[model samples]
Target: MKRIGILSDTHGHWDEKLETFFASCDELWHAGDIGNIQTADTIARFKPLRAVYGNIDDFKVRSAYPKVLQFRCEEVDVLMTHIGGYPNRYEREALALIKAQKPKLFICGHSHILKVIYDKKYELLHINPGAAGRSGFHQVRTAVRLTIDGANMKDMEIYELPRS
Candidate 1:
């Protein structure tokens, strides 16, 4: 089993709380808007990082990460992007990608709102881990952790810190 920690919209900020919350995770997934390459490097040094660049990211960040990432973790097919919408309100590009990839877990971060929803139409779990940086309008910084064992995703937890 691999433990995964997920976050998004860091906007160049990194919190010590994340180190404590994600210490046990085997990997870290950043949805996007990472702000800069320095932050990305820091996170990569902490744990294996899988990331996509968000709209706000600059050339350096975009060069370091893909716009969309699709891969398998254990037995689960996962798709990640920075601007993908949730459920029925998916963005056009994301919707097309979802239909093509048919991932079991679809993750995106752009709205700065935390959401967890199951899309029955596509049979996938969608997660938006909110904004983990101080630059956003979000009142609380949030992240998610879960265990992905084989095809099962369980033991989900949320870590929230009041924005300072």
Candidate 2:
């Protein structure tokens, strides 16, 4: 089993709430808008990171960060991108991209709303950890960490960042 830390839409800040629990994860995945390479470097200090670029990401950031991430963790293939916008908006582009690859876990950002919806029609699990710190509803800034064991995942932990 591999413990993974997932966060998204952190435009530029890493909230204090995440500091303590972060280093314990086996790996980290960012849905992007990370804001700077320094952020990536910081994350690297704790564990290897897999990241995707958000719409706000610049060319420089794209050069430094992964545009898309695909890998196997705990027997499941995972695919990640910056925005997994609803079909009503992008109309199948995101779905097409993900479907073509057939990853067990599909991660994305951009909406700033947290979602963990399963698509029975496709047998896919989609995750959107929402704004980790930099942007969101302002009601709360959230993040998720979980352990993947075979086809089953456990230890789903959520943290709400302290108000800034």
Candidate 3:
């Protein structure tokens, strides 16, 4: 089993609580809008990171991470992008990618709204960890933690803090 921590839309801010919450996680996934390279570096130092460059990210961040990331973790096929939208309302590029790649898990961040929905049409789990940083219009900063065991994903948890 692999413990995973997921967050997005940091816009350059990092919370001290994040370190403690993700301490036991085997990997960290950043959906996008990471804000700056330092924030990315900090997370990378804490744990293995899989990330995509967000709209607000600078050249340095874009150079380090791709606009879209598709990979496998154990038995799960995962797809991540910064502005991929959600299920039926997916962006053109994201919809095309979803049709072509057919990932078991699809993750994206942009709206800074937390969502965890199962897409029946695509047979995939969709997650948006919301805005974990102090920037943005989000009322609450949120992050997600879950366990992936083979093809099963379980024990999902959400951590929320008032945006400071």
Candidate 4:
């Protein structure tokens, strides 16, 4: 089993609370809008980071991370992007990727609205960890933690902090 910490839209801000909250996680996944390279470096220093570049990310971040990330964690196939929509409202590129990749977990960040839902049509879990930075309209910054064991994902948890 691996404990995964997920967040997005940091917009170049890093909080100490985030470090503390994700201390026990085995890996970190960032959906996008990391803002700058330093923010990505900070998270990578903390743990292994799997990430995608967001619209606001600079050339450095985009050079380091892909626009779409697809890989397997344990026995689960996971796909991540920066601007992917959820369920029936998916972005055109994201919808096509989802259909082609058929991942068990689909992760994205952009709307800065926390959402966790099961897309019954695609048989996948969709997670948008919202915005973890202070630069957005989100009143409460959020992150997520979950345990991925074999082919099952469980023990999901959310971390919310007032935008500073």
Candidate 5:
């Protein structure tokens, strides 16, 4: 069983609370818009980081991460991207990738809105951890934590803080 922490849209903002919330996680998955390379380094220093670059990221960040990341965690196939829309509303590129990869878990971050939905048609779990930075329009910053054991994802949790 591996504990995972998921977040996105940091926009260069880092909070100490994130450390506390994700302390137990063995790895961290960032959806995108990581803000800067320093922030990404900070997160990587804390734990293993799997990330994709968002539209807002600069050349340096884009160089550090890919636009789409596909990998396996335990027995689960995972797909992650930045602007991937959820379910039937999936973005063109995202949809094509989904059809090709057929991942069990699909993760994205761009809307700055938290969502956890199951796509019955594709038979995958879609997770958007929302915005964890102070720069977005989101009223509350959020992050997600979950346990991926074998092929099962369970013990999901959320961390939220009012934007100030």
Candidate 6:
């Protein structure tokens, strides 16, 4: 199995708590809103990062963030994007992507709040790591880790990391 760390909406700043959260993963998937290349450069020190361009990400950031990433890791097909579509209308967009990609795991981030939902309606699992930035909402601060096997997945358990 692959230990994957998922983070999104960093908004260009990183705190110590997120550092601890991402330490255990083999690879990290950044779901955009990175805001700057410096953030990506910092993360690269820990693990290889796969990223996508967010509305806030710019040219320098895109150089580090890919629009979409697809790869097989630990026996699972993983697809990642910063914002595949919209959260309020996730089902429709997710179904479309699911039908087209047929991936075992699909991850996205754009919402600054953590979310992990399994849509039986479309047979897709979506993960959002919330914001790991200084301007993020929610007082506790959060991030997520996903463990996967072939076509089986579980909800991402949320962890509140301290701000330092």
Question: Model 5, residue 158: what's the lDDT?
Answer: 92
Q: Give the TM-score of candidate 1.
A: 0.99
Off by over 4 Å in 4: none
**What would the per-residue lDDT of candidate 2 be over residues 58-95, giving only the tens digit for each residue?**
78779987767888887888888887764334326577
Score every model by TM-score: 0.99, 0.89, 0.98, 0.99, 0.99, 0.84
Candidate 4: which pairs clash? none
For all candidates in order, the CA lDDT equals 0.95, 0.77, 0.94, 0.96, 0.96, 0.73
lDDT of 6 by residue, 78-158 (tens): 778776653346546555766787776677777677777765654556677777776655555567886665555544557
Query: Lowest-lDDT window of 10 residues in candidate 1?
Result: 12-21
- Candidate 2 TM-score, true structure as reference: 0.89
- How well is each residue in 1-164 modelled by candidate 4, as lDDT tens digits? 99999999999999789999899899999999999999999899989999999999999999999999999999999999999998999999999999999999999999999999999999999999999999979999999999999999999999999997
**The 10-residue segment with the lowest total lDDT in model 2:** 85-94
RMSD (CA, angstroms), candidate 4: 0.5
lDDT of 1 by residue, 53-157 (tens): 999999999999999999999999999999999898999999999999999999999999999998999999999999889897899999999999999999999
lDDT of 3: 0.94
Clash pairs detected, candidate 6: none
CA lDDT of 52 in candidate 2? 87
What lDDT is reached at residue 150 by model 3? 99
Stretches > 4 Å off in candidate 2: 86-91
Q: Which stretches of candidate 3 lie over 4 Å from their true place?
A: none
Q: For model 5, where is the 10-residue window of minimal lDDT?
A: 11-20
**Model 5: residues >4 Å from true position, as ranges?**
none
lDDT, model 4, position 87 = 96
**Which pairs clash in model 5?**
none
